[model samples]
Target: MDVLYSLLDVHIQQLNPIIQDKTFTNTLNFILTTSTDDIVSITTPILDRFCINILPTIDHNIKSLILESKSMERILLAADYPSLTKLKLFNFKDNIVSYYFTDESSFRRIFREQITDLILIYDKNNDITVQREYRNGIHEYIMKFFHNLKYLSINGPSSHLILDDSSPTTCFSSILTKLCVYVYCFQDCLTLLDGRLKQLTTFIVEIDHSEPSSIAHNMNNLPNLTTFSIEYRCNTTEFDIQVLPLLRRMSNLEELTLIIYNENRTRLVDGTYIHNQILLHLQRLYKFNFYIRTCTDLNNVTYSLSSDNIQQTFTNIGYRHVKCILYNITRMVICHAFSLPFISNHLEYLGNTFPSIVFTRVTKLLVFDILPFEHEFFIRLARFFPFLKDLSVMNLHPQLCKSDSVNYDHNQQYPVIEYPYLDSLHLEDSYIDYVEQFINETKIRLPRLKILEVDYRKLNTITKQFTRDVTRLNCAKVHRLIMEKQVVFPKTFYVYFPLLESASSYSYYFKK
Candidate 1:
């Protein structure tokens, strides 16, 4: 209903004159279709009045093609009406048309400067028989006409846009800052744009996937660019030496996104080693995201591994190397490596406290998949990172289920005992037994515990022993008890009335 109203609103002005007029007001509703032949004859005067602009089709069979006075100038005059802000042409060929209109003296004499946004969409319903020379001419004229244009979009056929080393270039120094190009045009346009579009800060390019590195290599030289997104539908192995370095050089760049498709079985030279060498040099890149196209299906790359093969293939990628390098990082997201197989080993390595003690600077750990060693390892890991605050656990392994689980060190009687300064905890899809154990352990430890979030899907083993133990505890400092599913209530509950704020699924802690 909302969509229908919005669609009708676009033609509201046209509809108003027809609806209010005494002559055609009797026709409450009408259906308009393009298949009919004599629309001009059948169309009511009211409807005709509203038909201010006819977006002529490029189809050869369409009878209502825009053919005003058989000349380009006359056609421009015919289409250039106060109500018509858009003009679309198809199967349009020849460069002479634009050259004749856009000569400095010619444009001043004829057009008198009225056009702002110009669009030329081709290759949709036409063949190569279209005039190539005319197409080039049209491009030249349009660029010159729209010097102050803010938005320009071009989508053309791959064949028509092939560029030669000597291809003509356009200058856009007249403050055309925001530009988006989703063209199938030739790659030489990149070189032509050199030092021309200086004011452009925001750019978006969706390239033809047929040829891989052509677009990427050309885009590397864009100077003073801050925000960029380039998407390819097919995959190619060419690294486009310019892309990586250009990304590193964009000191003012805040947001960047790249979507690469892998259509061909092309193997990329492992550039992680190169990235590692260059990381130290990229002083401005405080945040970085790197993704690769290993397959055609997006999901294939997303959830690439199952639990069975996770651990074995964990250490192969540059994840370990990169993680090691960026150990000091606080906020980071590495997508492809989110599965159980990849993360378990990294966690285990951090958790291990053996012959030699290695420290992890990570304070807030967010683990996705549950591993068998998480429950046991975190107990030891907390000892090392004494100032750790947030511990968020998502999918836990069934094997980590223990009866009375607590943050207990098996070697408590040993020489050294390290205690972590944990404040907030988030447990999802955790067993009831583990939850009870966690709460019991926190009774004696975590004196500064402020929030506890528990999402227990299966509460099979929330026995009386667990409830009794929880009731016996005095966690006076704990303020929030957030429950998603029902909690098996302990024998007796201490309701800290004044201190407790709210018990809800979603919680917020604002950072000043």
Candidate 2:
């Protein structure tokens, strides 16, 4: 028998059994090094038990600790962690910031010499007005305390916290190698990386559109940087020109990811030029991911490039290592926007004007915001991507119904569109009739098909009833079925399919 232990949500009742078992106790001593929870405060009973009984036994084994502001002092004082090298502090309050850095505090001695990796997360729930000031003060104070700190992560709403250049307390450790923070401007990011963090190799920052040109100029200062990522929220095409030049400066970058929420209308010509430029410039880049998001209604949208245009654009540039997808944003009850992956390589031919392009090597595809009316468009996708294995479609317009006039028998006379390697299919908020027909038609073509996931949140009462009725007739060779909600199936389903068991209310798996 194998047993796994987790420190999350641990119950006091469960502790007695583990304490009694000598083998389990030994395992606990080895495993319970890191406190891995975002708990605001530890209850007195749990705290007392941990300090008096638990910490002393496993102190030496602890290599890392993650604690909330309220419980950090009590837990650290419980026992000496000689092996502790990494510490993460969360939900920090302004009042307790000075205590930990003071000479009289126990943490000063423990962290001053040994700690190398430190993560400080500000409480997001706190008043936003004061959080900024608190974060800056805490960051400045803690930086002075850790003499050998190499890796630091300051996570909060914004990475705008800037250290005073003239502050006598400013201690930029030469040993620091990696930094992750959210910056308000590009200059502040450069200030930290320019000369202060000379040894920094990995830097991740979130910046606004304030100073795009400055990035390319200042990036050269951090010659040691190997991996760099910038996330910016902009709705314009002007940033593209600014970004490409920046990429050219980072010749040392091995991995790069750009996430932009593009609000401005983009044309195919501009997109094509940018795509080609990245490939031409980033010669040493091993891994690159580009996420461009736009807000537009599916009812009236024009793709800048067609599938053929996208394929030809990349082909023209002699680049085939990228994949582009168009998503249909659906407004859900809980979330503002829920997007479904839609229109992979062949989306160019989908008659929509949205520019879609992807590498020929891509096997998995996600398409979103497809009109339920287009049945042939969906079927033709499999024929385009012969290598497609997994496909997920979301936010399908609900009005479109499967054509009852078309005879499957007559259709069988023609050459069937096939995806021989296709394995997994996922549909979200789409019409069930069309899905059933698509699956039934493609069953033989998809021999490797194993999983089918359907989200029927938008299915009407009549459509849902029709769906349940057609399940037996629409049966495909899929091994697993995952639904958004629990479904009541016909008794015949179980009789015909004995191997299938309900793994959960929303999931059904084949036992075999």
Candidate 3:
């Protein structure tokens, strides 16, 4: 009903003035004035019509306006938006930016006092000179006119621009609470924040170089800062030296996210000593996220274990609290040497060097990015993690399902391995037959399992068949099945399994 009314509102606005009635105008006015409503987008033609024909009567009713750069000036000048307080500008060009900041511009007269939240977006072009100019002009424009501006976002090429014009003595009226900008302008932004935005509580910055030490030094100035994020791209050695020490000073930080890139994969294999040192200082920290990426040679690489004597190399060190998902052989060796507790790797890798001390405490596990092996390999892997609750496996071979030569009934004679606490399972890019075989043959029932997510884009024609088979299974414990693709079940199937239908109290649908 709301969608229908909104559609009617759009069509009525498009009608000719002679055809527009009082009821239509009233409905349009109600939509414009409603503070709870969001006017998401407005095209050039609609904006022009509103400014020329309708705005004169309902100018004071509008609370927010989102305009494109092309029509921003014309729209602002059409009427005096007395109640407007929020404005967002898109595709803002260099010339238009400069024009609006000038003293003579009519836009400054109407919106300068009321607009507290402002957003400016520019095209990300390869031309460095144009970007620099736009950044300088836009920064100057904001500082001059929008003295009361509280929330501001300047995205794109402005990150590379250095604000040489801003001085330490300049005072700004706005007390910015949140800021997102690039590393190049970080120092200048701090200079601006020194006296102006002293109350800022959140800061998100992107670092593209190896100067994390300098960034850390600047962060001390933001004493009131509670949330800090650093998206760093550099080598692992540099991160260890420059980035780790920086974490020690952020005592007031409540949440932290570090996205680190490693050019040298060998450096991370040493263990979590550096990470542990950093974690020790964050006493007030409640949320901590660490993401690492390393360069890999995709063309010529073999994941096969070289020796059976690998288990003799591990020494039980005190680095048991660290948990990680290792990608290759070097990382696996590194984890073993450090005695890291949790691991997510291939069945082949685990079979060759299964460490008892490390596997006993692992609660989360993922077997990903490996060649397919038999179902027996998975059964062996599950035995290692006694407290395992979450499991995600990808790319298993389909032969495990069709291997009738080996009797699973004999395998079932062994004690059934049940993960009592395992509530969530995710399988991606695997054969449907293998999945069915694992569920049926293993006879492993997760009584506490509530969520099951599967990705079957690899199975095209038999996707629905797989869905049907899963729904018909004895999965009484499962409540929600989240699939990558949508599935439709037959009405008779739902009718026959009325208890399953009652158990799942909601309709199954794709989550966008």
| Candidate 3 residue pairs in clash (backbone atoms < 3 Å) | none
What tens digits encode model 1's per-residue C-alpha lDDT throughout 1-512? 12222333365666533333333221112222233111112244433323332211111111122211113343333332422223333323344344544545343332324434434444333455546664332433455665445444455442233333433354334565655565343243354345556676766665553442333333444546666655544433333433445455555665565444333323322234334534444444443443333322233233333322322333453333222210111121122222211211112112122221333443555444323433455556555445556665544445444433333423232232223455666654444444544454432255456566765333223323334343233234557756674455443334431254555655432110
Runs off by more than 4 Å, candidate 3:
1-44, 53-61, 125-131, 134-137, 157-159, 163-174, 185-196, 211-221, 269-275, 294-325, 329-512
Report the Cα RMSD per candidate. Answer: 21.1, 12.8, 15.2
TM-scores, all models, native as reference: 0.37, 0.53, 0.48
> How would you order the candidates by TM-score, starting with the best?
2, 3, 1
Across 1-512, the per-residue lDDT of candidate 3 in tens digits comes to 12222343366666434333443432232112112122323555665567666666555666666666666767678878777767767665567656776667776655567777776665433344443455444554565577666666666544343555455434344466666655453345444445566776776666545532243223454467688776665564666655565566567879876655555444332233433566567778776554444443433234442222222222122333433433454333322222242222211223223344436654555554444545555566667776666666655546434433123333443344466666656654455644544344244556566556654343222233334343334344556555665556555534433434223222232110
Predicted structure 3: lDDT: 0.50
Clashes of each: 8, 16, 0
Q: What is the C-alpha lDDT of each candidate?
A: 0.40, 0.54, 0.50
Model 1's lDDT to the true fold? 0.40
- Candidate 2 stretches greater than 4 Å from native: 1-47, 135-138, 163-171, 208-221, 235-238, 265-275, 294-304, 311-323, 326-512
Candidate 3 TM-score, C-alpha based: 0.48
